[model samples]
Target: RWRIGYAPESWDACLNWARARKIPEALLETAGLVVRTDDGRVYDRFRDRLMFSICDEQGRVVAFSGRILTADKEQAKYVNSPETPIFQKGKLLFALDKARRAIIEAKFAVVCEGQVDTIACHEAGLEHVVAPQGTALTEHHARILKRYADEVVLMFDADTAGQNAAMRSAEPLLAAGLVIRVATLPGEHDPDSFLKANGVEPLQEIITAAPGFFTFYLERLTKLHDARTDRGKLQIAQQIVEWIAKVPHAVLRASQLQQTAMKLGVPESALQQELRQYRQRDRTVATPAETTAPAEDPGHPAETLLLQLMLTDERVVPLVQQQLAADWLSTGTAAELMRKVLRLHAAAAWNGHTSLLGADASDEAHRLVTRLLEEKRPAPERIPAAAGDCLAALKRAALERQFQAIKLRLAQPGLSGNEVTALQQQILDLRRNLDHIPRLSVWRSAKP
Candidate 1:
C-alpha cells in the first residue's frame, strides 16, 4: 500500500517538466506519487526542472528528485521533498524502490550516480538500476543497497569527478563485504548518453570487460601523465604504487602489483620493495622532533599554497577558487578550508579573525587561514615579479617531496632487476631535467 498527494498545479507542472525533459510518462505513472503543496500554491519542489519520481518497494511513487533546467535567480538546480512519513533520503534507495525484487532475484545491482542515469538504465531493461539523490552514495545508501543485492556494478559517469566519487564509494562498499565491479563508459558518456547512442549492448560489453578499480585507476593515471616520457612514466608509476599500497586484500594487491609491473615494464619484486621502503621512510620521517615544534602536517601544503596566493596576490583569488574546487582538492581538509574562505569571500563577511572549520582547526590550518586573512596584500604591479619567485618555490617544494618519496622507495630491499633499472632511469631523468634548468641561464647569457 502507498499513499499519494499532489497539488493540481503541481501535477500538471510536473508532467510538463517531465515531458520537456524527455522523461517518459510511463515512468511517471508507474512511480505512483504526486507533487503537493500544503496551500495549493505551486510548490518549489519540482519548479522549472525535470522531475524524477522515486518509487517504493511496491513500485509506487514515494517521492521526487527534480533537476533544474534553467538558472533561476533564486532556485536550487535540484530539490526533493522533506522527510515525509513515507520518504527519507537515507532510507529511500532512489530507483531501487522499483528494482529491488529484480535485484534480489538477480543477485546484483547496477548503481549509478544520478536519478536520470538510473532511469536510463531502467528504460534500457536494466531493471535493477539504482542511484543516489544528487549526492554521493552514503553509508546508509550502501546498507540499503546491500539488503537487495550482494554485488554492485558502479555505472558512474565517465568523468574525473565521477571516477573519484566511484572510488570513494568503493571503500565503504568493500568494507561491507560486497563484491564491487567498476564500469566506465566510453568517450565521456554516462549510462544515459551511452545507452542512447549505442544501445545497451555496448554498455553491457563494457561492463563484461570492466577492469578492477586499481587497474582502471592506473590506466587513468597513465593517461593523465603521458607515459611516453621518462619523467611522466616515473610519476605515473609512483602514483600507481601509492594507490596499490592502500589495498587491504593481499591477493588482490599482489595480483594488481604484478599487472602494474608488467604494464610499467618493471619487475614485481622491485615494485614491492619500492612500496615497502616508501612506507618505512614515511613512518620514520613523520615522527615529531624533540625540543622542536612538530613539522607541519604534510597535508597542509595545499593550504599553505592557498594562503600564499591569497595573501600575496588577491588578484589570483579566482584562479585559486578554480583550483580549490578541482576534484583533487575535494579529499583534503585544506581544500575544505579553501572552500570556506571562498564562501566567506563571496558573502563579504570574511573578517581577518574569522576562523575556518572553527576554533578546533589544526595549528597548521589555523595559521594558514589566519595568514590568508591578515597578511599584507601584494600590489598588482609587484605580482608579476612575485609570481615567478612563488612559482619557483612551489615547484621546488613539489620536486623535493617527490624526490624524498622516490628515495625512500629506492632505499627498500628486494627490488627486481627491471624495477632497479626503471628506478635508475627515473632518477637519472629527474637529475637531467634539474640540470637542464640551469642550462637555460647559459643560453640566456650567451644571447646577450
Candidate 2:
C-alpha cells in the first residue's frame, strides 16, 4: 500500500517514454500532457517536478498533481493535469480512496485545503482526511463526503482566504446534509505546518473543540463587521438571513433564524418579517409555473423503478435477469444505466451510490443518478413487493413493444401471405404474454 512510483523529471525522458510506448501526439495533446508550439512541435508539459498521483475512490490514478522540486520565480509552484476523461478537478477529493472508510468509522471527515495538508494529516494518524485539488470544495465533493460523514470539519489555512473558502463551501456541504465545523488553527498556519510545529495532540484539541457553523459564523461575522452600530447590526442581520436561507431543512432554518436574531440583538419577529419579505420578493422574481417541478415522463417509470431496485439490492439482480430482457429498458437512459450497473455489479465494484459518481459517467447520467437518489425509496420490508411491481411493469412494457412492432409489420404494404400469418401469430402471442403479466398496484400498496 505504501509503494512509490516515479515520473521523469526531464522533458527528454518523458518524450522518450511517449515515443517508446507508441503514444500518439494528438492523445498527448488532448490529455494536456504535451504542449504544441507555433512551429507544430510538441513537448512535454511537466518537467523537473515531484509528482503525486491523484486517484478516485477506487484507488485508480486518474490524474497527476506535480510540485516543482526547485523553486522558480517565473513558474508556478504546482501544476495539475488538465480536464480529461478521468480527471475533473472540481469533483475529486484527494486521498478519498484511503480516507473514506476512516471517515465512516470516525463519523466525521476533515477537509484540508491541499494535498500536502492532507498527507500531513494522514501522517499525524488522522486518517479521516481529504483535500480539494488546490481549489475550493465543490458540491460533488460535498456529496461524496456526505455519503460517509455526518459532519465535515474544515481545516483550511488560518487566514482570510481560508475563512472565505470555508464560508463558500459551507452552503454546499450543508445542502448535502452535512453539519460543518471550522477548526481554528493557532496563528497563521495550515494543517501541515501546525502538525509539524506542535505535533498531533494540539491539532486534535483544535479539531475536537471546533465550533459548529452557527457559532463560527457569528464570531467571524462580528469580527468582520461593525456590529455595534444600528446600521451595522441591520447589515449583519441581513447577512445572517441570507446564510440561514441556505439551510434546506425548514426546522433547522427556523432555529437558525431565532439564533441569528438573538445574536443580532433584534426581536425574532422582526427577523421573521424580513425573511417573509425575502420569500415574497423571491417568489415575485420566479413565477409559480417557473418554480414548479417538471412533469414526470410516464414512459420510463418502469425502467427507472427497476434500476432503482437493482441499485438498492444487488441480491435482486438475478431475479431481474431471469425475468426481463435488456430490451425492456430500451426506451430511455435506463437502458444504458442498467447495463453500466450490471457491469459494475458483475465485477463486484458497486459501492452503492458512490460507484455512480466520477469521470466515467456523463453529466446527464450524473444528474439522473442524483434524481434517483433524491427520490423517496421504499422501506426494507417493501423491497420485495416493489421489485415485483417493477418486474411486472417491465414485462408489460416489453410485451406492448412487441405487439406494436408486430402490428406495424402486419400493416406494411404488399406483405406476403406467410409473413401476414406469422406477424398475426406473433401479435397474438404478445397479447397472451401481456395478459399474463399481473397488473401493477401502487407499489406501496402491493403485498409480499
Candidate 3:
C-alpha cells in the first residue's frame, strides 16, 4: 500500500523531528524535504499539505508529491519532489510497487495520469492501475511496464491535453514492443470521478471494451485535422505514417499502412509513394561533399546491388520493407526506384518495370528499374543472405547518421541542463544499438 500522510502547519515541525533523530540537514536537502534560504537558513518544504510518498518498484520511499490543503487561489496547487540520487520522475510510476503482481495476473497494465486516479481504481477492485509521478511517459517507464505485462491501456482525462498525452505515449510504448489500447472516459470524468459516479461495473465495462490505440489515435487525429480536404488529408497521412514507423513489427506496419490508406481514402500505392519519411526537413539527403556532417553515405554501391536482388525475386521487396527503414537510402535514382518497387509490392500491383514506368513515377526510377532487371542476380537460395547483408549495411549507416545528429545537437548553444542530459542518454542508446547490428562484411571495400 502507498504511504499517504499529512504535514503539520509549523515550518519548524519536521526540522525539530529530524534534529532530535540526529538526521543531518544536508541529507534532508538532498532528499528534497526542506528548502534552504539565501542566507543559509532551512525550513520544511511541505507545510500544511497532504503528502503522497512516491516509491520505487521495491517499495522504498524516495520522494513526495504535496497537495495544497487550502483553497487559496494565489498559492500553487501542488509541489513536486525534485530529482535526487534515489528518484527520477521519468523512471518511477506512482503505484507500480503495489500493482505489479496485479498487472502480471491481468496480463495488462492500466496507466492513468495521476496518483488519485490510480488509488481509486485499486479501491474499485481494478488492481492493475498505475500512474506516472507528476511527469509524462518516458521510455524508462515503458521498460518497467514491459516487465510485468505485454499490453498497456492508457486512461487519460477527457480533454485536449489528455488526448495529446495519449498520442505522445504511443511512440515510447510501441517502440518497447508492448500492445497499446486506450479507454476514454466520457466528458471531463477521470478514472476517479467516473468510478465514484457510475460505480465499478460500468467503469470496468468501458475499460474492457476500449479500442486499440491505433483506432483511438486515428479518431482523435481526424477530429484535430480536417479529413475532407486534399492538403488536410496529406497532413493526416504523413502523421499516421510517422506513427506507424515507430512500430517495430513489419507485418504490423504493413497492416497499419493498409488501414491508413483505406481510412484516408487514398490508394495504397499513393500512400507508399508519397509518405515522406519522418522529420524530413531535419535531415538532408546526404551528399559526398558534406562528408564532415552527419550524412548518410548515399553513394554506397550496395544500393545498386539491393536493387538487382529485388528485381530477381519479388520476395526481396517485403524483406527490404521489413528491414531497411524509410529515408535510409539517399533519395537518389536507385533508392527512389527501390521505394517504388516496395510500393508496388505492398499494393499487390507489381507487374514489372513496365507497370512502374507507365505509372506517374519518375522516368529515372523507371530507367533504373529496367536496368536492374536486366542485370544477372544471385541464386534464389542465396538472395536472403545477400539482402540481409545489404540491409544491415543500410541500417548501420542510418544508425550512425542518427548517432552523429544527436552528437551535433549536444554541441549547440543555449541548451538547458535537462536537454543536455536527454541528448547524452540518446547517444548512449544509439551506441548500444549500433553494437548489436551485424557488421557490413560485404560492403567492406565500398567507397565513400
Best by lDDT: 3
lDDT of 1 by residue, 172-210 (tens): 666555667889887799899999999988887887777
TM-score of each: 0.49, 0.68, 0.65
Residue-wise C-alpha lDDT for candidate 2, range 294-366, written one tens digit per residue? 6644455767776777777766665664454444565356656775665455344667766777788888778
Cα miss at 235, model 3 (Å)?
Answer: 2.0
Candidate achieving the largest TM-score: 2
Is 2 or 3 the stronger prediction by lDDT? Answer: 3
- Regions of candidate 3 where Cα sits further than 4 Å from its true position: 276-411, 416-448
The lDDT per prediction is 0.62, 0.76, 0.79
Clash tally, candidates in order? 3, 0, 0
User: In candidate 1, how many Å is residue 337 off?
Assistant: 43
TM-score of 3: 0.65
